[model samples]
Target: MSNESNLQVTFSKHCNGLFKKASELCTLCGAYIALIVFSPSEKIVISQVPPQNSGPMQFIEANRSAKLRELNAMLTQINDALDIGKKRENELSDLRKKNETQFWWACPIEGMDRVQLQLLKKALLDLKKRIGQHANMVVSQGTPTQTFPFFVGNGSSSNMPIEH
Candidate 1:
């Protein structure tokens, strides 16, 4: 307002300050930014971007391409598909737990060698015998008694039969 004749000088000072701030931001925070200003006199007063950043024109062209839009759509679809898969996996896990509770023998057996299978079989048989003995005692006494779960000295809790 005070020095209208110094239009060029004013523009130069403002541009220098803006660029300095932009550079500081880029260096301190590792952020790349672009600042563009247009004056009323149809003059492009300032355009600043970090050295590593693309020009405004290049940024616009890359963002506006059809291939970029297509890739974004594909990535969104893949993320949605993965979410659905996770939900389905949770549902199947619940179903498996329910089925195992109903029929312990039909539980999914994976990554088990022959020795492990034999040990599990022995543990299940011991559990069955214990259940039968506890039931007989309950009938004779007409009251349930506390029975500890069958342990096979293995470090696994699920080594015991799936209790109904």
Candidate 2:
């Protein structure tokens, strides 16, 4: 054969081999391939691997939907956390209000009603009686009586004045 014909045959052989390798690679890796070859004789050869399913658009849409679902799940979790935080805040606020409204003996008596004042007087009298009892007990036990400057007569007075 002439040199030109031998070159054409060699070109055809190599081109066929390249196409086969490309086909093998595409099949093994599940890849898309588009190959175009122009022979010395001005002939065109085209090879393409068809994509699976609808195409890239379908894949992209599915991926987008998955991402949106994930984002919505995250948003729901955040909303639930915010609701829990609000509930906790409301509980703490209620506790604070209850503490602020509850009455204590040490609190200021300026805003007390007449009935409240009577209750306070009774409580103070009861406290004075208990203190006198305790003092008597201590004295009976042979413990020397300690004079407090605030007491008028050895802590035995029923009308012991209470100091604010």
Candidate 3:
């Protein structure tokens, strides 16, 4: 099979026949196929399918069932991608939340406006100065410095480019 805008009747018919056989097999014995077709003109086409509920292995029935299986696989992949993206987004959000709890003045500044990022940086700088004084006080009193939280916000304060 080939890609490169397969608008030819013979090519389409062959592709349909291949898919039909694949469908018959899948319906009869729970088998599936992952088909990859490359064209001589520098293009590639990938087709995949999943098991489906089909009637007797006839052309019309098989074609309908095979089409449905293909569509199902396509939709399944889309859904999976969305779910994973959302899950990772949620995980990163949770991590940022936890980091903020530990370092109230420090958090990821992505998706934030310049004003917000600047606010965060200023807040962190002030917190660092305050803690430095607190550290000095603790040292003078000969107490453990471990009790004070460490504020380690990496990168330059010029995180976001300011616009004129």
RMSD of each: 15.8, 12.7, 19.6
Per-residue lDDT value at 123 in model 1: 74
Cα lDDT for residue 57, model 3?
42
> On a 0 to 1 TM-score scale, where does candidate 3 land against the true structure?
0.32
Q: Which ten-residue region of model 1 has the weakest summed lDDT? A: 153-162
After TM-score superposition, the amount by which residue 65's alpha carbon in candidate 3 deviates from its true location, in angstroms, is 1.2
Residue 90 shift from truth in candidate 3, angstroms: 1.4
Candidate 1: what lDDT? 0.69
The clash numbers for all candidates, in the given order, read: 0, 0, 0
What's the TM-score of each model vs. the native? 0.33, 0.33, 0.32
What lDDT is obtained when candidate 2 is compared to the true structure?
0.69
| Candidate 1 off by > 4 Å | 1-107, 145-147, 155-164
Location of the lowest summed lDDT over 10 successive residues in candidate 3: 155-164
Candidate 3 per-residue C-alpha lDDT over 29-89 given as tens digits, one digit per residue, 9 for 90 to 100: 6667788876445377677866665545455577878999999999999999999999999
lDDT of each: 0.69, 0.69, 0.67
